[model samples]
Target: MPVDQIPIGTFSRITHLSQKALRLYDERGLLVPAARDICTGYRYYTFAQVERGIRIRHLLWLGFGLSEVEAILEARERGDAGTIREHFARRLAETEREIGRLHAIAEVLRTQDPLNGGFRMSITEPVIKDIPATRALSRRERGVYQEAIPRMIGEICAYVYPADGRQPAAKVTGPIMFICHDEEYRETDADIEVALPIAGSVNLDGTAIGVVTLPAGRFASVLHTGPYPGVGKAYERLFAYMNEHRLVPAGPSRELYLNDPAEVPEDELLTEVQFPVEDLPLSP
Candidate 1:
């Protein structure tokens, strides 16, 4: 062994990086060892690599992905603070979003916890009816359906009921309407529009808030009672009804919240699932 060469064990201990991690970095060429025994294939590091090993540890501790850490190290080598700053900024934004998502999850667990007994779902027979036109203040966004629904609901309500003691711009007429504009189910990046039915006129005051008129349509609607997680079963039943009746969905599906989730327990929450449908053509 060379006098200056440090064995993998000593290197791992000195840098506080595991031998497994050191091997990964070597394979990734992020922190390759100084030398290796040709016959035994054992990795050896030098004192010069101690600084880089510590840097890698620090970067990993800071939550940088392996690839991002490599980029950061390369940027640092070229004195490219801008690149480092960009990575930092992007990571900062992602961390903020994750924090918000966690907060939302906590709120759900506190208010609408359905995990106690796995909220039992009860669905009623589907009914075909004509839906009337109504005015609503809506927020349409693209995101994960589950996470975005509650967050956007709060966002829209905040505007109507400002924190400061100010008069509400519009009167809430009915439960919120959640419309999914996608033909297929999506875990993320699905188009979601949440509309709050309002009777009184709303003064937008040049804001981005949208006032939409829900067009009249024929829809197959069903009543679902239980937690939102089990609401998919209700959807399945509704679609089965449509299939039996030879009806095809003509537009996006919607869910009208029949009860305030904040006030009701998850097992007792009510939601009306509706899907616009049209009759199939007769065979010639």
Candidate 2:
């Protein structure tokens, strides 16, 4: 019972940290009590520990892990402002990325239809057409779907536009398109290819970037105009049409960007969704 030692309950009240959390922190070697009665095994922390306890709670509130909190505490003990700055800068970047992801999720939720309990239907009708074979420059990558698509497209455009002396691909045969190779919806590690149709070939180098031919085929297509997040509804409509018409998908799905997103408002962006299909006989 040292005069400087504070009982666990009193320390908990002072720091606003629950007894369970204090015990867990002790178990994790994050915070150790100043003394423990050998007979009763009751924990006691010093008055000075109250400041550390409060700091730990604040760090936890800021989404820092136990290890990170320990590191920050160690940096403070050493009076290393640089280390603290580095840790906080890294955390700020991570928080910004999380915020972006949450905004994207919110956008998707906003576009859902309450009646259908699904994404709002955007396209009323889809056209069936035969697409001609074409050659193009492409870049393929695997990453989070919504976040990765735009970045990959921008990288491809950056490389292609300047490599060709700022000239638009001769005749620019078709709109910029993305071939979705994944068979099912994926939140991460989606297989995507960004392609630009060129009337003539240009030399390009890179393992992930190259020239490739897009196969010609009959496709069931719909035009979706609005933010990209609402494109899911267009896919729902396309699949429904395919099921009703008894058509089987023959190849990967494709999305043709009809306008530059950088130039138009997100709500006004245009995209043409196409799914290659094979026709089956209608049932009597």
TM-score of 2: 0.71
What's the lDDT for all of these models?
0.87, 0.84
Deviation (Å) of 152 in candidate 2: 1.1
Candidate 2 lDDT over 145-250, as tens digits, reads 6656777788767766666577753445678898999888787788989888877766555535787899999999999877776787788889999998989899
Clashing pairs in 2: none
Which lDDT tens digits does candidate 1 get at residues 1-284? 88889999999999999999999999999999999999999999999999999999998887899999999999999999999999999788667767876764665565653643344668899999998988999999998776678888887888889899798878988788899999888877899999998987788876557889887899999999987766887888898999999999999888999888889977798999999999988889
Best by TM-score: 1
Q: What are the TM-scores, per candidate, against the unseen true structure?
A: 0.75, 0.71
* Candidate 1's TM-score: 0.75
Runs off by more than 4 Å, candidate 2: 3-6, 10-16, 28-35, 46-59, 64-94, 101-121, 163-171, 205-208, 279-284
